[model samples]
Target: MRRAVIALVITAAGLVPLLRYHPNTTTTAIRATAGTAQTPSASSKAPSTSGTRTVTGSEVDTEFGPYQVQVTFNGSTITDVQIVEAPSDRRSQRIAESAAPTLRQEALRAQSAKIDTVSGATITSEAYAQSMQAAIDAS
Candidate 1:
């Protein structure tokens, strides 16, 4: 009985650190990026949306940090997905750089933000999709 009690104490001791440990994560206000689209000009008042237009998506907060994407449309088709502000952490940056292109392609090809997310980039993928969808909605 005493040995069992000691083993239980050891197990609880091992689990304490795991429960208390917290990884560093960042959260900050969204800032405009170079890729952010500008307001349309008076001359750009098209009866039909033939010209390209860009829309910024809503900021999404994820485990690593805040992320946002800007989407551009050529008429009704999505032509681009720009990572206006991806997660600032190094790990997130690497993941984002790799994921952004694929996300853009998928968004363009799908003509929507509802594309299959990259396997290892769940947080980035979700933020990308949300931001793209926001742009599409704005259009």
Candidate 2:
């Protein structure tokens, strides 16, 4: 009984902080949805930088590795987004292959850092969103 209680205490101690953590939301709604690969078309171009400013997000560490993003904006509107850093692990590579395009598309469509979380890539998605928020804040 004592050992079981001790184990439970240890588990709770570790998980509580994670549960209480919250990243500042940069946009309105972040719908949790299925992750899909939606690569931008070759002809698709982000907004021109002629009248925009660029800002890079802070590096956000996740369970897998570090992640970051750069955002270009024309005044208050987000013009384009670029992934500046992310994990290169094999599993992360496979997940990013699919998740990256989807995330980018979503960001463009929404025009903000706030994005729907990818179902299978929760950690990466959260980190991505947070980093996006950081960039916007800096911009």
Measured against the true structure, the TM-scores of the candidates, in listed sequence, are 0.68, 0.60
- Those runs of model 2 whose alpha carbons end farther than 4 Å from true positions after fitting are 1-50
Superposition TM-score, candidate 2 onto the true structure: 0.60
Give the Cα error of residue 35 in candidate 1, in Å.
21
Write candidate 2's Cα lDDT for 25-79 as tens digits: 3343432222321222232234333456677677776656667777777756777
lDDT of 1 by residue, 1-139 (tens): 9999999999999999999987765454333233443333343344237877777677776767778887766777777889988767688899999998888888888888789899899878887887676666667
Per-candidate alpha-carbon RMSD to the true structure? 6.6, 12.2
C-alpha positional error of residue 40 in candidate 1 after TM-score superposition, expressed in Å: 8.3
**lDDT of all the models against the reference?**
0.74, 0.70
Q: In candidate 2, residue 121 scores what lDDT?
A: 83
What are the clash counts of all predictions, listed in order?
Answer: 0, 0
